[model samples]
Target: MKRIALTVSAILLLFATAEPKQKKAQPKKQEATSVQQEAMKVLMSGFSTDPRFTWKTQQDEAQRICSQYPSMEAMPAQAIQKVIQLSQADLRYPQWGIFWGDWREGKKIVENPRGGRFASYGFSDSPTDKGGNCYACHLIEKGMPGGTMGPNLYQYGKRWNITKENMNTQEALERVKAVYNIIYNSWSAFPCSSMPRFGHNGALSPEDVMNIVTYLLHPDSPVNK
Candidate 1:
């Protein structure tokens, strides 16, 4: 009986010790959350307070949801659906409709590496700097250096089977619209994608996005060559 009582006492002591350790972990988690909040405040204070930049510091509904997960794989199904719904709902198209724009003009926007980036140190973008800076993430044309963060798009138009003979067909128009939607709001198709929502955020206008779509889907563009 004495031995059984000692065993019970040891088990009770273990439970008591484990309970405090579990309780202690809760405070550490709270402290970590506090630290993260403080860090965000410090980072936001470094940017200029210009009205144009105010949007950068603020998280929209979709952004607030996305910020909770580190990556798409970590996101819950409900969260992913919510983000996609929000992204699709916010899409806007050019008043002229979703037709091919000037591919040559589109090429300039694709290759030019200046636009939308803001800094106070003499590097702030001028209103005229409307380049998409696409080469930063994609290889649009042959012989052009580009990053590997995104898939190689050296012959994007050719891969899509876009040809001048059929470029005006309903199927081709559908393809054009699909690509346009992706550029305008990538999260509509890919929740939590690394691709920026250029048109959705006004970084690029609808016309600009249409031109980019033309650059990628028009057979005559160098992206097909």
Candidate 2:
């Protein structure tokens, strides 16, 4: 028993005096930097720009600003306002004097899923391969399977007080312009919106945007009905 106790004491003493294993600190930011560089290199090697479609590989001023902040709430009011101002400066009004378009055509554009990231260079060369595909992000009609990425715009016109009954009124014109502005550059209205800048990026033409507006605001349109 005495010998066993002595052996145990010696073992305990050895353990108490033993050098502790040091945990190596991981340089997380450095590792992240290396991974990001590798990813960029891979992307650059794979993508080639063509006349019809080009990838926006480089970050723009607004994108850079937005990336630095996690969310719009985290961003400064001044910065948000600056994004709005910059976006508004790029706004292009419709060539036609009237903002309205045929809602029927608008419905076609909303449902069509052609020109977008999928239509980029080497994927499609058709000029008519572009459309709004608004239904992908909004529930604009009843019983239609739509993505829930954006808010339900089922009664957009009615909620906004836009109707065929109010079409010729001055209020309708102003509301039409407001919707036009949103479709043109959502960042103008919401500095860090997930919505695309359809008009600003030339993804959708002025006429195309007007058509979408008609689908949303027309009284007889499914969105309003």
Top-lDDT structure, candidate number: 1
- Model 2 compared with the native: what TM-score? 0.76
Candidate 2 weakest lDDT stretch, 10 residues:
15-24
Candidate 1, residue 135: lDDT: 88
* CA displacement after TM-score superposition, residue 209 of candidate 1 (Å): 0.5
Residue 146 of model 1 has an lDDT of 91
lDDT (CA) for every model shown?
Answer: 0.77, 0.73
Instruction: Give the clash count for each candidate.
Output: 0, 1
Residue 219 in candidate 1, Cα distance off native in Å: 1.1
Per-prediction TM-score to the true structure, in the order listed:
0.79, 0.76
Best by TM-score: 1
Which pairs, if any, clash in model 1? none
Model 1: residues with Cα > 4 Å off, grouped in runs = 1-33, 118-127
